[model samples]
Target: MNRYLLAGAAAAALALGAGAANAQAKFDVKVGGDAYFEAGYVDQDVDSGLRSTEFRNRMRINIIPSAKADNGLEYGARMRLRANSGASNTRTTDADRAYIFAQGTFGQVRMGVSNSFNDETYVTASMDYLKLGAYDDVTAWINLPSSTAGTVTGNSILNPSIAPDANSTKIVYFSPRMAGLQLGASYTPRNDSSNTDISRSKPTGTLAGTSNGIYQDMVEVGANYNNTFGGVTVKASAGYMWGRAVDDVVGSNYKDLNAWQLGANVGYAGFTLGGSYIDYGKSGQNERTGVFTETTRNWTVGAQYTTGPIVVGANYKNGKDAGSLGTTGDRELQVYEIGVGYTVAPGLTLQAQYDYFDLDNDASAADDKGNVVLVRSILAF
Candidate 1:
């Protein structure tokens, strides 16, 4: 079946299931969303033009419809879309997210571009998960090319070593909760319009000759676990990713590019402490032939406390990268950040965060430092 068409059919089935419950009664639609303004500032020593104000951040709208069927089938789908892009803080867009799923004894099977199983693995039960502090550059860092071809060297300050692109369809299955452990997984096709395949590897001929097919093909997997003993709650997770480079003329230049991460969080009496570590392997590329093996790793420790309607948190992140990707510097980066968040009401949050980036190079020619600040508000239903 056509994937998009199949997804549509699934959504229709859910709507039908929900409507059947109202055949003998009246049903009302439930609607929700949030709109907010943001301001941001960046201090990069090299490129001053990137520094700006009130860069349009995000204007959001969301909706969901759900109903119980006479046959015991409960069905629903959540829809979200952005109305604008950029200006308020950093660059963000008004986009849409939709999902269709059915609940069963085993669990729930969701279809559409939703959160992948790999994504569920690292997030903890901490309040920061719902805040901007999640994946704050200062706390979580990785080693990757400066710009694909090794023109620069540093941590993934402005970007992540691996990030999912939009419209990337995934199938996620959530298992029944068992002693605080939840397992899940997702599979994505090698060729999808949303397949970004952005990677550190580049087409050798492009920089030196021509531009052709050069994209990364890959798969990812992860798991999540949480348990409570008495008054103490603990959460932990691990994940792995692997991909191949299709260099077109050069064909598959590398067989494997792999990475993994481990994280943990502990909470007690309205206070929580968290830490994590991530490493990207140096298994691919012919470093001997000028394509150097690059690796990145980092560790973070932070805490959060909540009182009444207010929550506050602060974190310290330390990052480092080694091996030269054709850069004259030591190929290392370090960063730190602190953040604060507040909950005004159920499902409504306001947050402000600031972080600094320091690119330390063994060579003197590279631009070695920068800073960033972000403030945001979100309404999730």
Candidate 2:
């Protein structure tokens, strides 16, 4: 009898393992990622002379699991593991983005750390090269002095030419595409919120009469349209964002921040052209008097041509009052880049880019101009 009992237990264990394996087979799961390696030489002529050659590498892995229920509802989750060799000391190689979504006839609802609707729907004329074209350019080669703060370094033009609050923890909804049009909306409880869950308790222990953070309770709405007429394809998008003040630092003088953007792209016969304009509204606050200070604006225009395995692109961007905290007269950046990309294999591409940047400030006599040349290898699978 004891021997028979042992045999029964072994059969049960095998049955349970088979059941679990069959259940897992019902869902589709995929693993993929990309790796990017870049080497560059930078030449600078800012307030002083600087030259450097650098090499950097970044890798990310994406795990995507999805299932389609019998009722026609599809659900999935995406998680990314990211690591970079050239990141700052504070940067961590961890799960940088994780999100889950459900979709069917009612469109898609995504929750967790993801890009806002404005950042998702807004169009740009820049090319999607290895470095994202105008988005990165060559601003890293130049360092401009801060106008308001004492000798603080400033960023390049690309950082300001786009909307703030890129990827944050939020809930987003996207409507189904209808007649070449789609709508999206997102709400974020806090601008600085990262991969953490929303906090129930209000943060404390800040300086008296000052706000806890720059922005809170943000809302973004956007629309995008894409269609092909004749032999040309056209895409356009517009977005608006608003955020409530975290505190009444400036009392009644404080107003909710607002921003908007417009962009369009046209493609024809292996050539694509596009442009975008963004307004970041009023984000600056006077530390001494706690008053709203300055507004920011950015614009870019670019074009690309693709033939077989080679792609070439060029773009120019301008930013005004890029340093939101600085006086209006002390913040302006202009940048331009030209690049070429060649596909070497099914999942590999090589690219070379040349970038130039200029920083101008009426309040400062320092010259901030620089250039960078970069070559990159990208592998995606």
Candidate 3:
């Protein structure tokens, strides 16, 4: 049944585009992309056999084909291909976004692999010094314990929202903005299925005290506000996500997903102040005896000043989650960050950042503190 629904949606979208095409105006194809190269140095308490320096780079291309109908409705499709995965110089490419969209006075509708409404429009702290859309680059530079991976919430402890949907096939709707407010919603059949894959098997939980994060029938609703009152600009976002957990085994007691996000920003006189809170209250943890469960959450606050071609910013982040399934409690992560960026030319930038981080682990031996410095060059067109 779910597969048929997806097929029908694809057919309908193609038909709409075909029937609405204007012979006088052909489809317009455009190409654009961005690239970055970075080098980093790290000093930490646990650096045994770990290299203090590393270099990394990535590139991506966005292919867009769009057209407008005679009645002012616009239709389009976009695919983003990236070369971001490499091990020992072996590189591979993959598409992270592929979607069909149509927009009119009613706003926009997207079908296929795309972000949720909240992921697309949520307002957060202004991070001008960070590269592109990155918020948790520190994770890539530091070694957090492997046991810190799962909480059934955000992709990582530093991520600010619940987006376990993982770019799976979905349908999203965005209402037209009115009086500085906009509303949106999205539905995903399964969090693990994407692209051309069709999954029909029902997910089942492990026995007793084990936990799993996979979910089905994910739904999200969100709203955002954007307005400028006199010399001050105000922006805010709120969102909620919920889903059904895997079917439990005879002795297992698994919890469903329930996560929410709130963020706000205010900017004036070239300075911006903002903060965000994300909460996942034991959303995907097992509740049986002998299993440790805790609230999964993170919050961030920051301020930045932009003057001419230079930008300076700083922020503090705190994240906590349930550690190992055994007797340990929550693990905490804290980071104090400061950074700067300078535009060398139109589409070119040079950036430098320094981060001081402390990790309080459930296991005493895994706890560590570190300082890192990174230099980067970015080009976009």
Best candidate according to TM-score: 3
lDDT of 1 by residue, 148-182 (tens): 32211222532222334224555555655688887
Residue 317's lDDT within candidate 2 is: 83
lDDT of 2 by residue, 95-166 (tens): 767887766666777777776666666788858664533375465445556444211012234552234555
| TM-score of each predicted structure versus truth | 0.71, 0.82, 0.93
Deviation (Å) of 104 in candidate 1:
1.8
Candidate 1, which segments miss by more than 4 Å at Cα? Answer: 1-30, 50-55, 84-96, 124-134, 137-146, 149-167, 195-217, 247-252, 282-288, 319-324, 328-331, 345-348, 361-364, 370-381
Error of 2 at 94 (Å): 2.3
Cα error, candidate 2, residue 180 (Å): 0.9
How much is 198 displaced in model 1, in angstroms? 18
Mark the 10 consecutive residues where model 3 has the least summed lDDT.
1-10
lDDT of 3 by residue, 201-264 (tens): 7667777545677788888889999999999999999999988887867766777888899999
lDDT of residue 33 for candidate 1:
69
Candidate 1 lDDT at 321 equals 49
